[model samples]
Target chain A: MQIYLPIADVSVNWLLLLAMGGGVGFISGLFGVGGGFVMTPLLIFIGIPTAIAVATQAAQIAASSMTGSIGYWRRRAVDMRLGLVLAGGGLIGTVLGVWFFNVMRRLGQLDVIIAIAYVVLFGIIGGLMLFESLRAMWLKRKGIRRPARRSGEHPWYLGLPLKMRFHQSKLYGSVIPLALLALLIAFVGAVLGIGGGFIAVPALIYLFRIPAAVVVGTSLFQILLTMVAATIMHATSNHSVDLVLALLLIVGGVMGAQFGAIAGRNLRGDAFRLLLALLILAVGIRFAGDIVLKPEETFSLVTLDN
Target chain B: MKRSALALLICLASMATATAETLVTSLSTYRVAINSNYTGASLILFGSIERDARTAPRAGPYDLVVTVRGPRRTALVREKEPLGPLWITRGQRRFVDQPVYLAVVSSRAIDDIAAAPMRERLKLGLEAEFASPLPGPNLMGEDFVEAFIRLRRQQGLFQEDPEGVVFLTQNLFRAKIDLPAIAPTGLYEVETILLSDGVPLSRQSTNFEVEKTGFEQATVVLARDHGFIYGLIAAASALVLGWLATVVFRRE
Candidate 1:
């Protein structure tokens, strides 16, 4: 069945949209990451205008992450103080990002910018994930054991002013790095139409040395806020958020995430990471090919609302 | 000289009577409601020609051309240049206030209907419709206009059918106009023109509205009129859906 999207001004297949949401939701639940990195590109591939796809996906991300964050909250795994500090920075970054988004759109270069951003961001993240997971598996098979990490050791940067203790993560770190990291993620998320949870989870793990459980919850929390900001910005400024499209996606996504959570219980961590890495790399390669390959039509047209 | 002038006057009088005609046209529907199930719509523009019949029965055949034009909007056309490894947008041309959707139906090929200037004046074909250029970026010649037309056609926003208009009888005729699934909702103008001996005898135009109705209309109004509230409702609904799903599935 086909349904007309109000703001996007296009009719799309409802089944295809539902399936895309389900697929992304499954990945989000399986990995404990918001699937904006996957959903945004897929939506564009299916012919949703890039601007509408980005804005509408932001709302979907917020919805998908809400339940996950709540589950973590019940387990007391969320670092609320840390999440709030990061969200503070995120809110500021979102303003700047949306401004830049409008500028590129007006110049008729939004598609190229989105494509390049996807190629670079996903390429690096996927490559690192593959390398790290492979190394971990290799080390596990070997007889030699790696040195245990020292939790108390603080990097010189963590010794900076405005230090705060995240009681749940059991670490004392300066807010400067955490805020800066959040700001960067929010800026990228606004422009690229993603929740940036995938980037945040790794950053918190490797850079801040936050515990795995806390990182997921904290990342989700920050993601929820960042996406809310994005949705509001796109709705008011660009008026590109399509609520009908969002509702259809959320229906499949909500259910799929539940099933994915159950399925994730049976999967191994390193193997799961490897699979996700491949998926990310595949999407990145597809985007890269779009730029390098000759286009079917060298000329493109868009109707501007008078 | 007097005899020649009188002969010319007699010929002109006969031609005027032969060209005297009346056109009657109506759409299948006056209002097109874009409901949820609306993929597209096909409307038949049926019409008839009433000739003076007082003149010597014109030996030539009659022709009909129908054109449907949707709301006009500005469009941007951009051409990409291969810049080393990747293609980059090199230049752009803007068409100001051009019909967003245009469909033309004719009994015969438009070019065969009349001379080039006449066809252009009547806007009988896509090329003729672009006679006036809106002032913007350097006019990149016919290539850009052709590109615009081709892109719109591919998107189902523009269409043409030479044989769409068919004559059921000598004076009665009908044409079919297919609005694609992606057609924009707005007021559309449908025009039918009668041609006799390569000269326009009569013309008629009617207006119809294609507006979203029911759920579709409500959503659009909410988003455009109350965007902030709409955003809040969207976010709140998502939160509720997520919470509900989690609670229901927790038992499993």
Candidate 2:
């Protein structure tokens, strides 16, 4: 099927749609990330109306994350109290993000803002991933036998109020840091239409210094709530959730995620991180290329609010 | 006593004949079966009608009608093109199966005290096929199958409602067509028509029966007996195969 967008004079192909869904699904399962970074660009490439794509991706994330987080909860790896608090902050942040999106739309500067966000975030994240992966590879070549460990703790997070102990995370941390992290990630999630797992997982592991074993499950728990809220908000507000498409992708993704989790269990910690880093770097480069290069043609569409 | 008995016997025979004359039209069963390779044949209702031609035959300044009635408040009516003396040419056939067009005529003008309202009667000229043209022959069978499903969706008809009345109105008439593939096959009236110019002239009707085919029977049995296992296997195979194909045909 080819759906024509009147303003852009572009047609979207169903085959491309299926491919994009499958590719994003696989990456999401493999990395414990929301894959929104990949999905938004893929949607644009395939000519989905921008706002609709964002909303639909949120719905997909909710389904995929629910499946994943349920499995983690069954394994008793989730910190419910912390996750809920973070989700509370996330909800507020998401509302702000949506408001920002509307403001940008009214200013007729959405495209520029999106372009800049993609470039800056991808550059930083991609560089970090590449550097870390290369360093791990070098360490392996030198026959280092030490286990990888969290290196540093920030004094700023330690000084924050509302200190809480998370038995699953095995750390005593200030709730303020966790809440702020959640808010920041939620804003990014709303803008990118992902569940914010990419940011959440890293923040849990590197900043909060949560044990690597529990980080995935905890982050997924947070993602599940955030995505569900986001999906509901988008659906009722924008009516952009394509239930049919979401069902198709999730039916496939749930089964794929189970297998991916099993595969992840078999990999070494360094090996997993290396693969994730490479994936992030690759995605970043792709985004950068799209921004810098001249597109085949320039097209515009009425903003979703219109 | 003999006169009364003779009249009763005549009424019984006439009633039987009347029941047999009603013409029926419907899309009772539809399916799109594809092979493991995603290539197979599918059937679509191109155009179908059972008309009671005895009462409303192809003659004079009259109209032919077709309708599809289904679940919910669903209704679609179409009318055949009107034939006039000027339209008939030297080699022109009696009827042409061209695109059906919707009737715009008001039913009140046709007959005052006899016929039902326009909504009650089957209007004609609605498009028979709901799907757009396939991009190519490779997509033909599946495309039609999808289109058929979509048509059912538009009418809110599916496994939920298996039967509905499709009425045809012109004058005092009754007919029906038993569509093929109605589960638990039995007798069905499909079509009916009324003939009137100055007075009631004649009426016609048709009948058909629906029965499950071997493929349909087998599918139903499989679904009832082993649906879960079959679905799991299909999902697994598709995932494994899709992954392998992507790996082999990896695009940089």
Candidate 3:
């Protein structure tokens, strides 16, 4: 069945949309990460306008993050003090990012910017994950164990001024680095329509040395609020959000995540990371090919003031 | 002198009535409503040729050409050029106040109906549309215009059907027009021209409107007019759905 989208001004196949959402959702759950990055690109590939895909996916991200974070919130794993600071930085970054988004769209360069940003980001993250996973496999084969990480050691970021206490995580550090990281993540998230949870979890655990118990919780909490701000900004400033599209995606994602989590339990650590890394690298390479390969038709049309 | 002038006026009046012909046209529906289930719209347009009582029967067969034009819009055609590793849009030409949708239907092939010069002069085909000097800031070459027309045709926004109009009788005719779902909503003007032996005789134009109704209309209005409140509502609704889904799942 085909249904017309109100704000997007297009007709899309309902079953295809549900399947696409479910597929992306399953991958996200299997990897234990937000699927906004994959969802936006897939929507565009299926003929949804790029701006509409970006804006509508923000709402979908907000919903999935809520589902993931609420459990962590109830269990008292999230660091409220630090998460609030991060959300504050995220809110400000969203405004700046939306402004930049509008400017690029008006210049008719928004599509190129989104593609290039994806290529660069996926390349770095995918390459790093592959290297880390392969090294772990080689060390295990050689019967050499990796050194245990000491959470007690404070990184050099602790020496900065304006130190703040995160009592739940048992750490005291400057808010500058945390705020800066949140700003960068939220800004990129706004531009690319990604929740940036994968990027944030690592940054929090390795760079800031936050407790592993609270890392996912804090990242989820911050991302949930940041995406809420993003959805609202996209809806008001750009008028690109389609509520119907978001609803369909959320429904499919909710179901797919359950099945994925059950399947993920059977997979081991290094292999799972390796597969995910390959998937990411493949998507990045596809985007690169789109740019470098000669297109059949170079001429395109655009209605002005869309 | 006054007697001669009166005679000349009477002679001219009688000559006008001897060869006068006019067209009459009507559409099945004047408004096309767009809703959630809307795939596309098909409407029938009926036309007839009327002649003066004193006029003699035409020696040649009558030909009809119907042209449907949608609302005017500003458009741009862009060409990509390779820069390093990426192919980016580098050249652009703008067209202002051009029709967003166009469909031409006729009794026979346009080439068979009229010669090349006449077809272009009458704007009878897609290529003829760009041959005319369109209003724009830049007067680009024919290549850009051709690309623009080709792209629009591929998108189903521009269409041509030579044998679309069928004559029910010598005077009456019917034409079916199909508007694709991708067609922009706006006013559409349909013009029917009568031609005999490649010479245009009479023409008439009628207009209709395409607009979104009910829920779709409300959604678009809210997003465009009351954007702030719409945004807040959208966010709140998503959050509620999220909370509700998790609650339902946990109970199961």
Candidate 4:
């Protein structure tokens, strides 16, 4: 079928669209990223409406993450109990987040909100990730012994109520904390149109002290569920999901993810973290730059009223 | 007889003077084709200036404006940037194979030091040059090949550079299109307009048909039958190839 874009006097080519989807999918797979960072902006650059881009990206994330999560699960990397608890909270958070997302949309303040979130969160998260990766590299160069165990007692996280043991992570932690973290992450994910893996992975590693070996798997599991919920919510409430666009990206992403998983196995811990950190930092910087600098032209569909 | 001849000469002179001050030319109408991959497309406008002397044909410093509209009668793109002797690339790429209407308007006030009345009566004719079918760089290799193949199979279809076509020195214009072999047969129209001093003066439109035959019908049927399964297999193969290529190329 011929699809025409009157504004650009251009027609859509299905083959080209599929190729683009595949390319983005490959990147996501290799990098273990949600691909939303690149996909959303690229869509905007290519003249897609922003809301459509975000919704379609969410669906794509759901499909691509399913493969990753399944792969990780097969490898005995997923902690189902932990993933489920976190996902339960994530569902609530995502629901709330959808409302908040719509509220911001209605207020015509999405761009400002997105800009601020990118600058603030990206600065903090990217900086921390960078610093940690760099420090790990420095220690390795100095031939310092790696810290494999904690000498002190379990921290305050262990002291909270409703503590439960995560067999895979081998830690006893309060379920409340896990739930709260999931909710917070999901809320951010919904608002930012991301899968929340970036926040969740870091939170699991630093806050909960989940072993690095299991962190990514556990995070993917949670991301998988959260994205699924987000997709359904957006589809039902906002009627925003563009299945055609989502499918195109997913087809490419699945292939990319397969390759990424293969490559990731070969990288050392420091190298992996450094690469991931740099990627995050790069995305953050680009996003921040767009917001801080005055655009040559600015147009929006939303009017300045809630 | 002498008086009548003088009167006739006087009338012709006045008409020539009026035509010399503002000239409108017809440019070729563009038939847009959209690539199905993109969600939409927009148009971009640009032009340059030229200068000239009296009785020497007008030269340089031409002020040109361009606007595009869709078949549904909505404004697609517009530009008003002014520059002298400029080659402007409107930072807009449309989806492939979709038909869109274009309207280009150009106006320039010639600086004449001659008598004020003479200048007022002096007329200028405006001409437009259409950019021919040139392959856009961004068109992926695969899409280009497909479009090229389709174009080759269509009878009575004039093959222009897959890049684009450029028509120079005519103002109001239109395109008569003949669809390709693989193309779904339909009516396509292109409209063009020329304006002087913000006033609409000349307008033209062209219509074309895409006729389908047995071969085209068979190709469509075959494509429909196995397109999904074929796409899946192709994608899988591409992934494997891409992976292998990356590994080989980046071996360390």
Candidate 1 segments exceeding 4 Å error: B1-19, B132-134
lDDT of 1 by residue, B1-252 (tens): 999999999999888867578788888998888877677888999898887656445557988889999998889999888889887788898988888989989999888888899988898888789866646665556789889999999998888899999999998999998998777889899989888677887889997888998888998888888888888888888788878777877753
The stretch of ten residues in a row with the least summed lDDT in candidate 4 chain B is B122-131
Model 4 Cα lDDT, one tens digit per residue, A136-225 = 899989999777777566778668899888988877878998999999888878777778787788888877888877888888888878
lDDT of 1 by residue, A111-180 (tens): 8888888889899999999999999899989965778887568788799999999898877979999899
| lDDT digits (tens) for residues B1-252 of candidate 2 | 999999999998876555432433333334322211221121211222333434234344332232223211212121112133111111111111211111111122333313443323332112212223423233334433343343333422221111222224442222222221111222323222333332322333333333334543443344335544432332333334334433443334
Which CAPRI quality tier does the interface of model 2 achieve?
A: incorrect
All candidates: DockQ: 0.67, 0.01, 0.71, 0.04
Error of 3 at B154 (Å): 1.4
Greater TM-score among 1 and 2 belongs to: 1
Best by DockQ: 3
Give the higher-DockQ candidate: 2 or 3: 3
Report, for every candidate in turn, its global Cα lDDT versus the true structure.
Answer: 0.86, 0.51, 0.86, 0.55
Question: How should the candidates be ordered by DockQ, best one leading?
Answer: 3, 1, 4, 2
Displacement of the residue B204 alpha carbon in candidate 2, Å: 39
Model 3 lDDT per residue over A129-239, tens place: 899899999999999999988657877877799899889877788888888889988988998899998888878877887788998888888988999999999988999
Each model's chain A TM-score: 0.97, 0.86, 0.96, 0.89
List the candidates' TM-scores in order: 0.95, 0.52, 0.96, 0.57
Two-way TM-score contest, 1 vs 4, winner: 1
Task: Quote fnat for model 2.
Answer: 0.00
- Tens digit of per-residue lDDT, candidate 4, span B1-252: 999999999998976555443333333333333333333222222221121243223343222323222232111111112233221222222223322222222232222222233323321111111122333445333433333323223321222221121223332222222233223334544333333433333333444333333433332333335443423332333334333433443424
C-alpha displacement of A213 in model 3, angstroms? 2.0
